[model samples]
Target chain A: MLSQENRLSFFLSFASLLGVLLIWQFSTLPQASRSPYGIPDGNAEYQRLMGRSAVASTVRSDFPTPGAFARNAIEVLHAPFHNNGPNDRGIGWQLGASLLRVMIGYGLATLVAVPLGFVFGLQPVIQKALNPFVQILRPISPLAWMPIALYTIRDAELCAIFVIFICSLWPILLNTAFGVASIRREWLNVIRTLEVRWPQRLFFVLLPAAAPTILTGMRIGLGVAWLAIVAAEMLVGSSGIGYFVWNQWNNLSLSNVILAVLLIGLAGMALDAALAFVQRSVRYAE
Target chain B: MTLFPFSRRPYAFRAAPCDHGPALACQCGSTYPGIFTTGHENGLPTGAMSAQASVPAISRRHFLGAATGSAALAGLAGLFAPHAAMADTAPSGVVEKPDLNIGFVPISCSAPLIMATAKGFFQSEGLNVQLRKTAGWALIRDKLLDGSLDASHLLSPMPLALSLGLGGNAAQPIRVATMQNINGQAITLALKHWHKRDPRDWKGMTFAIPFQFSMHNLLLRNYLALHGLDPDKDVSLRVTAPPDMVANLKAGNIDGFLGPEPFNQRAVYEEAGFLHVLSADLWDGHPCCAFGTTASFAEKYPNTYRALQRAMIRAAYFMQEPSNRLEAAHIMAQAAYLNQPEIVIEQSLTGHYADGLGVVRDNPRRSGFSPYPYPSMAVWILSQFSRWGYLKENIPLQETAQRIFMIDEVRKQAAALALPAPEDGQNNWPVLTVMGQRFDAFHPPSYSKG
Candidate 1:
């Protein structure tokens, strides 16, 4: 289905990726030196312990080669959902845990933000009164909420969910308020002239008009929720993909960590894509 | 389920084993041994297990040979063998709670909690014990305080510090059920300072300890002070977790750290540091971690508490036999447990370790397990606490030990199980010795002249 230029671009991208892989493979070969200039630099004693030859001690270069990484990827990704007790689980299980937490927290945030936002949209005085607090809380890093959250909540799992809720809540609330407030004054006049019931006027006119903006806010919120879940899960440290990455780092297992990083990226992308589809569905033409 | 603590932070140093540009590498060619789930948990022992269950039959053969040669050993073998006395003494008709949760940091000192869970010692007394690894001693204390954990492997000094209101919780009154292990901690210095013999030469150096309320801090302070360096003024002490101790040492952020085992051994294996001195030698027979719980938990479930104490003591006894060390190491080195390299754990447990200076050192007390919570040991801890600024108020060492240690209950439980009871030091406490001077037994806790 691709055009000739599009096909050419795809081949060029594939070729560039191949080039990068080769460079990485050769530079990290067993003979590669740790020093930047491709030579081992250390005290005479260290050189003697690890011979004067430029070849690295297999233990010294913690990074596995590209072949090794691919091998690990295939082995691990092939059967991803193995549950290994509470602390150690497979990649699929961890990803599922993370996705579940993000959705629960994000869902709760939407429930509250939408209703409260409607109130603020209808009343200018209420929005003005809340603006200072909202602005201050919005810019604060979500992870900073961890210590206070843990202290007050006492449950680490709840603290993680609470943090995600706090972080995602602001965006949806602000955007929903903005969307509702900016609906054309003429639309409200039309509904009034037609004697449209309060519920009908709100649902049919206001919601349809605001759907695109609300979806945009949700898309933004989803991205932040995915990002914030990783950070929050890292601190709580019970289970989740974030804990898998942390535990691997503790073991000094870099390949497993790389696998986790890739999974987190893929998960974030998929979540954003889902929201993007919703945004597309709600788009309105002028 | 143990806590992994932090997943994404600067704690993750790009495994720059070489200048490989963060290119992911295999975690060695061997597949990581399976992490077990509940299905794997039933019937079959999965992953790295203490080959000890099979060991009892083999151990009996050796015990028979030894027993045939000696009369005293025959009696000892009968005592050492796993007994049904634990099941016989279940009090209160039924346990108020059979399913219990205990948290422990992943260290060799946590042998009691770990071995009990690993060997089905907890299951023997009808207790379904769930053991989880906590991030640190402070977190363990918090978990127990908040009732998230039923019991935890705690530092000997921690409950006392909490009871004394030194670390707050004025009348929270957590109890020490039994000691987890004894005489098993060491001071390790980064490779750069391995040659610096004198503590006097180490002024202005920063050292890491597991916690402020830990014996590592107290002992490090005592060791430095003995060499004429005021710990508070001369050298800075940072509270670092056991797992991060080696990494921080490699980064040279710490000059040295007096921390728990396997971590100290781990440093040497990684060639980041060398053993400076064993805490066992510094203060022989000091209590490290204890199987502890809130006094309220004990009051509410006496039978359950007794069952847990019996299980832990038996597990501690199992860990004491030299033959069990290798098996214990294997059990702890699993992904579901300590999740460490088995050889590193084996080295610490067996006391045959590479000291990071190319020579192998052997010392049987590198890490030891003893279940008895001696009152004198508690007194000694309180004395050290007073010596440092940790304890501000004047304390009656004897009365304090009696209150903090569950000595009367532990003695009854040990005796009922026919396990040897540590002599109660009720009337006369042991002489507080070492640190370049000896203080009489009856002196107040603030008597340390240093």
Candidate 2:
């Protein structure tokens, strides 16, 4: 049922992935045996003392190969809901904790930004008055606020949520304002001549016109929120995917850290796709 | 014909009597006298009493009385069970606040606190404890001051630094209830420096310590100064977290580090570094970490504080036994605790480990668990503070040591548990040897001339 070009593209993607894995595996293979040049007098004891033995040195390599990563990934995913203790939980629980935080933070950002953005769009003077502050704050990185937030909030979980809230606020606010302000003036004039009340005019005419832009803004905000949560969780570690990464790093298990990175990427892509689907639903024909 | 066949024989009369004599017959004796006197006073038939008494045993009157007395007393005890269950009181005092939140970093140094939670020492003392594994020491300090943590595993000198308002936001009086571990740190250098053993040959090399206010820092400085290299001008010191120390070493970002185990062991495990020297070799029996809390928390919950102290002391005692170390390492290596390999923690705890030179050495004093809070140790730490210019003005050393160390409280708690106390005069200022030089606590050497 697929077109020729579509089939070719699929083949190419698969081939590229195979190629990368092949390269990774080959690079990590043990090299040919070489003379122990650094050892003095060709002494076996000296070579062993310096940790230059072939078997001992390769027992735990600096980087894990693709094969090792695959094995570790399967093991981690096999029991994704196990709870060992407060510091250690399965990947499923870690993802669930992170998603919960993102939802609460993103939902709060929407509730505040949509309304205030409407006000900014409707009133040019008000937007101008607040423009300097918004521009100043938006460029600041989210992690920069961590120390101040920790000191003032006095709670680690709340501080992480506060960081997500800060990062997600700006994009949604700006996009909503732009969408509402750019609405066709002819439609507004027609509504006014039809003697429509302000409430009906705002809800029926303005909301529908700005729906797509707002959705786009939400997609961007969600992306930023997801990005900030990992770093925040790493700083204030107890339980989360970020904490799982940190805990493994402390244990010097690089393969597990790589596994977490993959999971985070997959979760981020899923969130963007979900937002994109919602955006399509709100699209209108020109 | 009887519905209950065994009921024909009186169960109380068939029960065994106490072996100890009547005067020392335990709780069972209390009811024995009452039962015997009651029967005699009631004038039970002498014919039956004499027949039973002739069976070559104690009088039937006394035997029956002791059995029935014990059963009645047991029933009474059951009647008052709810009150006993509600309080769960320890022998010392009723715990005012049984639920607690104690914080610790994931290192072998926190073995006492972690073992206490795992071994049920806290529960035995009627305290419900939740151990929070924190990210770093700074967060531990912040959480403790903010009241989120009831107590925490702190650096030995941290309480003194916090009280003096040197490294913290405000001056808060903190109390060191017990010393957690002694001499459990080491200086590990990158493998490139395998041949650079002499400190005099090394200049411009950066070293990482866990914190500026840590004993690692002071000791590293002292070691450097003894080698005739100025720590300030010759070498760069960075304050890095323990978890990052090994990673940084691997990346060639640092030349070496004087950090707590098992990171030093971890570096050797990873083949990124080799153990250059153990902290124990530099200064034997130096204090590394302490079990600490704010003075206000201790005052507000005195009984709970005592209960915490007792639990930690017992845990320390448990760790001192060489037989219990492997078990301690196994429990601590789980995901909820240190989250490390069992062998790595075992190496650090048992003091038998590969030194990364293909050599396995054993020195049992590599890591010690002692609950004594010696005031002289505090004075020594303060003198280091003065020597390093951390103190803007010289404070009264002995007064500060006595105020913060809580030696008297520790002595009293240790005695109550029937543990042997340290010798008399051990708490006073005394001369100690470090790196083959005598350090007189009475007259600390002046570093101002340098």
Best by TM-score: 2
Task: Give lDDT tens digits, candidate 1, residues B1-450.
Answer: 011112111211111112111221221122111111001111111111111112111111211212122223224434453234334443324777999888878788887788898888788767998787666676677678878899999988998988877865555788899888766788898887755757888899999999988888888887788678889889999998776788899888999999998788778766678777776555545678888898899889988898888788777767766678889989988876787788888877866666565545566555667676656667778887878877877767767776778555664454444443232222224454444245443554354544
List ranges where model 2 is wrong by over 4 Å.
Answer: A31-58, B1-90, B423-430
Q: Output the TM-score of candidate 2.
A: 0.84
By DockQ, the best candidate is 2
lDDT of 2 by residue, B1-450 (tens): 222122122111111223222322133333223111222111112121212111111111212333454455334434443233223222347889998999998999899999889888788778999998888888888889889899999999899999999864689999998878777798898878877778886689999999898999999998888777788889999999887899999899999999999889888777678778776566656779999999999999988898888778767766755667899999989988888878788887877766765556565556667677766678778988888888878787777876888766664554344333333322334355565566665566777625
Interface root-mean-square deviation (Å) of every model: 6.5, 4.5
Q: Pull out the clashing pairs in model 2.
A: none
Off by over 4 Å in 1: A1-58, B1-93, B168-171, B422-428, B432-441, B444-450
DockQ of each: 0.14, 0.23
For candidate 1, give the DockQ. 0.14
lDDT of 2 at B3: 21
